[model samples]
Target: MDETDQAIVRLLQADGRLGHREIAEIVGLSRSAAAGRINRLIESGQVIVRGVVHPAVLDRNSLAHVGLVVRGPAEPVAALIAAREDCPFVSLTSGPHAIVAELRTSSAHELDEALSGLRGLDGVQGVETLSYIEVLRDVVGPVGETDHRIDDVDAALLHVLQSDGRASYVDLAAHVRLTPAGVRRRVLRLLDAGVVRIGALVRQPGRDGQAAMGIGLRVSGDPRDLLEQLGALPQASFLARTLGRYDLILTLRAYDPAEMLHGLEQVRGLDGVTETVSWTHLRVVKETYAFEGLAP
Candidate 1:
């Protein structure tokens, strides 16, 4: 969107839970005014507010990503994919599968079970999966910079932390050229302000060595509520609100598709959940959460 909106996104990308007031301080705007702008950005489809879960630490087993190559026109197949709550970050672009998504989870067993469910889908097409063995880096921040209100320090903080969410206060202080405590204060402000949230990521699904499966969910309830339920569950990760064909997009790791199906069954007639679609990942070459910025 516009510069102000981009600034808001930049702030939230660092931490989705940041409040309008803190964001206003970072972005040089009034709290109410910053909130108005953020609301507008979300309404315009340029940015969204969502809670992000760290799968690596949260789940002992985790699902990295899945590639779905359907057998028909991309639109309808994409629509089916979109409706499922488990398939949160989907992209229907110029690719072999017509639809690609980064499924986040930590269970090897759950991952396998989800694959079976995907094979059962009516489309009757091919599926490919890629699992991330090593996460070189991960960042949660806006990708591009169209927002001009942010200062150099703020921008640098966004850029650096997007690659490493757990950067220490000492490192941040050094990079930002502030005292360690100063950096810590700023970081605390960022978190309290909702500019960013930091937590340990569960690299796998279960401590018992069970596999995790990635399931995509499309729900009828407020996407946020559905995400809250899934995120609160010990198996889900990588929740997002998207546009194009779905109201919300999310990824979850379960002991197996049955458990996921069971989860869906539990959530199914609820006012918030409508449908859940799952796909097991075959392989993952590259997966990064580093801010790639906005899509032009």
Candidate 2:
């Protein structure tokens, strides 16, 4: 990605629903040029734009990371796991574990059902599940409670954006029976209210030697203080406090293997971090942030 590409990405990460005109103004590009770059980014499979609902919407939602030790080929196994609706992220890893899957379910029962199906898959030897009790930070936005309530019209707009964050205002207006101006206003309001976050979900290619690691940290100090420190790290994408073998979990992505190692070292060198475990991703099968299915 070039500097302009990076700028466009940052803007979208801040608010995915930004129009081409708005993006162009910030990036100092013509409207068409900005649109072209964004299209290229999306077409190249480097970025995915979508509306991600905050976890607060679903009271009983259960999100977990499952480590699988497969007996045979990991590619096919990862592909199979990626086919399921609940398994948004499935990757073959290069640690003691052969595969890692990020599963999301609306309830505990649904989570159990998904886990059972995963266990039944052939070549799967074992499954180690880590449930996230509180997600301190996610891909595009922080996970927390929502103060504003969404009406049916608001829900419709969000539902559409959940599928396509760059959907045109005219199209959305048609869907919600509002003028183009009305649709734009509503979307801006939703973003300002923190009811939803629109941003790119980047899935870097593992074959290119980009470093992707899952680090579990065991801290010895106050949880809040430790969490604050971890959250500021550049490479950390998904960080959360859990209730299992590890006190915290982090998903890190780097441009190269060296940078990845550097990030790992930085985390280990933190003051309160007592111990750490790392897993390298060999292949990322799926990366999605759409929350349409969980929308209220």
Candidate 3:
């Protein structure tokens, strides 16, 4: 990606619903040129802009990370883990474990059933799970908004953009019987209300040998101070305070194993952190930004 592409990506990263005109003004390009650049980014698999529902609106609220030790090649097992609807993230990495997967379910029973199913998969050796009590922060936006109360028209727009964040205003208007301008207005209202978040979902560029890792920190002291410190780190992506065997869950992306290890050590060395466990994410199979709440 070039400098202009990078700037565009950054803007969309903040707000995928931004207009080409707004993006052009910020990035110093013609409106058409900005639109074309966004299209290229989407087509090149560099970014995906879409409407992401708050977990509060979903039936599946339980979230957990599972680490797997495979008996043979990890790719096939990763594929199997990826195929499951609840397993949104599956990776094969070089670490203490062979495969790592993230599971989202509606209840504790569902979580257990999903983990059991993973254990029963062919070539699976063992499974370790870390259930999330709560997510403090995520890639999409802040947590703790459980207002599943959108009206029919707004719901329709969300359903449409749940699949295509960059869906045209005309198409959305047709779906909801609004004018193109009306659709644009409603979208902005929803975004401003924090009822929905739209942004590009892109993989961490591996150009610099970057790797993503999951860290479980066991904390004995007040977590706020430690969380603030960890949150400021550049590599930190997802940070959560949990109530399981571990107190905090962190997701970080580093240039390589050494950096990843160093990052872990830095967390381990923090004041509130008592112990630490880490896993590397090799591949991400499915991300659950799309929602079923607005579906018919």
Per-residue lDDT of candidate 3, residues 1-296 (tens digit)? 77678678767867887899999999999999998998888887767788876655566689887778889888888887777777766767666688877787889999999989999989988987777777766766436655546788988998998878888999999999999999999988877777788876665445325466778788877776687789877667789877666788898865556767777778888887788877766566556466565753
RMSD of each: 17.3, 2.7, 3.1
Poorest 10 consecutive residues by lDDT, candidate 2: 287-296
lDDT of 2: 0.80
**Model 2 steric clash pairs:** 16-198
TM-score, every prediction:
0.44, 0.87, 0.84
Can you write out model 1's per-residue Cα lDDT over 1-296, one digit (the tens) per residue?
A: 44565456556655554667898998899988987886665555344344232342223234445566677665665566555544444545443455666554446677677666666667738776665443222333221112223346654665566555546667877888889888767656544544444432222224322233444445664566555465455444444454324444444444455766665565455576656554443322223333323111
Residue clash pairs of candidate 3? 91-283
Per-residue alpha-carbon lDDT of model 2 for 113-219, expressed as tens digits? Answer: 99999999999988888888888888775377677777788888888887788888999999888999998899888887877888876667554334678988888
- The candidate that wins on lDDT is 2
